[model samples]
Target: MRNPETILEVDDLRVYYATPQGDVKACDGVSFDLRSGEILGLVGESGSGKSTATGGVLRTIGSPGRIVSGTVTLDGEDILKYDDEKMRQTRWQKLSLIPQGAMNSLNPTMTISDQIADVIETHEGRQPADALRERIMTLFRRVGLPERIYSMYPHELSGGMKQRACIAMSIALDPLVIVADEATSALDVVVQRVVAQTMLKIKRELNVSFIMIGHDMGLMAQVVDRLAVMYSGQLLEIAAVRDMFARPAHPYSEILIESVPTLTERKPMKINEGITHDPRNPPSGCIFRLRCPHAMPVCSESRPDMVEVHPEQLVACHLWKKDENGSYVRQSV
Candidate 1:
């Protein structure tokens, strides 16, 4: 059953990049949802299409890349069908983005306050200077930034502070959904934790939903309510964080979890052993079959649809089948 609080739905999304050889399927048939006030983490190795998928959702893919097919429904409206002006208006008002690098996202010539104020003015029209100042300051306080840094430039603030400032800017209009693309990746461990905590705090206080993209399983474990595993332009699995860590349903998910280093046990890294196929010419069947250890003959003949293997856990793999009791069981190769 779909949650009543579902705020965003991405269905059958396919993003392709143009090349002389052919169209590279960067995000192929990916689907997921973001419920109100929930933090959903999109996790995968590099080139796994995490960023490309989100870029498609945000309608920011540049030339040489395009959304081949998809429906990005936000608040019951298909944002993919929106025009340029409508999307520009919708951005930062209904949906906002906190990019990967805060320093690169911010303007070096403007102060922190001015940058945030510019977003407000551009969207809501001009505001009283005094009221705008107070509003910006309140946003800073909400994100754990100090007032002393309001007049400072991007270079003046530390990496963490700049990220928090970006967070503040993202929420200036109280957008219903925020796509945070590796918002904390460039920070140190301590700062990463701090920024993650700030994001959680914002979620709790403002009832905002988030789609965070990253490669850090540890941080995702700490912050995200659910995890979505992607590989070679396809989503392999999505489940509650606890359910995924305890028993991942897909072979790739299992290998990804095992690849995480633990203090209590040491295991050989199995994530790097598989051979990756060219993006321009992916295999005909399952995209992961080239690297999957449990590859079956059927895996080479057909692509598997996502199936509910357990309560609220969905996986796309050829190794699981429904029994007479209607429960998913591992199929013997």
Candidate 2:
């Protein structure tokens, strides 16, 4: 468990799209907290608002994208009101993001060293030209990349190496919390492991937290301390990694964990049916009710409230109630 001194807190975080038809709720009433040296995994199928929720914290959502309602608090401070100047100053220096498809995030035209130097030069003020090369070299070695790769362009290095270079750039200022939006989603299995390992190294060295976003349950299990499961823009569950894998309270979380591929698992993988509804116009009630096998009448009548079931374990499902005899019975997922 992370120390109670929280570094980030997101309460009822919502990001929406102002479409011609109506406002699309990309992230709806999302809330979570993070502490130093902790990794919180945000897992959901595509368009489930995994990235949108976190992206709102970075204020990276572009035009047509708007945070409809929510509060993003960093170190007990609400950042939603930050002006452009404040955002520019706080970004990368206090908080940084290694966005999804980070391979393309780097400027292909610029040298690897130049890219890292750019962030340092922009935020850290001017320095002698001679010092810039040395700083880049120090960061490269910190991320376990060869110092010789500094002069090379992004095309020269392999995917894993490029990821490491990006990591070096991400931690150049040792930001409090790093948002990694599917940081390893684009790589092969071997490279994914490599990238995850390199990320661990960087995390330990910097003692920073990570908001890792991905749908791969197994991959997230390996790195994340706590898991936040999302379904159709709403966070359905958050629990310790072991509890979430062993006894997932939410039906959505159980499906995700059971879907993880295993060596001894010769049976066909469990696949969740039904597709995510378009954000422009969503379902009438619980977003997952259409696909949720255990859903009941109440699920379709109204959305469930996120209630605390245990320490650090919150589930947004009606299943956590009792039946006639007072025995806890899960709802018809």
Candidate 3:
């Protein structure tokens, strides 16, 4: 069910990759909502399909990967049905990507001004060259970049500066939603903090919705309004950041939060043993059963549906039984 305030709705989204072995279900029946100006942080280990799920939103699934079935609606319009040309027009203007390696995404030969101007020309070509330059300069200032850096090549700027430029470019068209996939993973802690602040500033100023994909739980806690935990191509839990940190519902989510280092809590760290389940041949019942500490016989016998355990929080786990009112009650131990 789509929320009334949702700007982007992903319903039963399934993206698969066809390989010689079999079909790899990169995104299996993922459904979620990105409300207007909401910052939703998607967190999971590598290969958990966090990036693939967001990639589906932009229809950027490359060769061998295809969105098998889904409806990605933006503002009541299903973008999946749009033809190639129509979809091309939606990029940047409606949605944009702050790629994983922002620095590497820039063109080595082109100046920052030229690259940003090119995006403006492609999306809103009616503007004059001076107007485009002015817009670029405004974006540069918005992202905390100086006007002088406009003529500099990507390599000429530092890593953090390059990332800021990427941010400026992403918001150049005033996109409604920005999918920042690992935008701060490569930067130092100080630089990461700065970039994160930059993103928050942009969001507050532009009122742009963000779907940030990263492995940093602490960082996510600081910025995101909600957290979506994924495992083996499936959403395990979704809740407000405060609620999630206070009490995680899913077993996988609990472990993920416990794994992080905290200044207040000093305890012996336990390493995760098994690897993530293979997407091509996931476990029959619950894909996470093999690693879940609280896994019961029922967990291995049937998959659990996502149910509301508390207000504004949903989780998929057999430990909780759903009642008539659609609220989940924990089974007696």
* TM-score, predicted candidate 1 vs. hidden true structure: 0.97
Clashing pairs in 3: none
Q: Residue 17 of model 1: what lDDT? A: 95
Candidate 3: where are CA atoms >4 Å away?
274-276, 323-326
Model 1: CA > 4 A from native: 266-271
lDDT tens per residue, model 3, 217-298: 9999999999999988899999999999998998888999989998997899978964456678898788789998887888
- Higher-ranked by lDDT: 2 or 3: 3
Q: RMSD in Å for candidate 1, one decimal?
A: 1.2
lDDT of 1 by residue, 220-248 (tens): 99999999999989999999999999999
- Give the least accurate 10-residue stretch of model 1, judged by summed lDDT: 266-275
What local lDDT does model 1 show for residue 25? Answer: 90
| Cα-based lDDT for every prediction | 0.93, 0.84, 0.91
- Per-residue lDDT of 13-114 in model 2, one digit per residue for the tens? 889888889988889999888878889999998888888898899988998998877888887678888998888878889899887786798999999998
lDDT of 1: 0.93
Global fold similarity of model 3 (TM-score) = 0.97
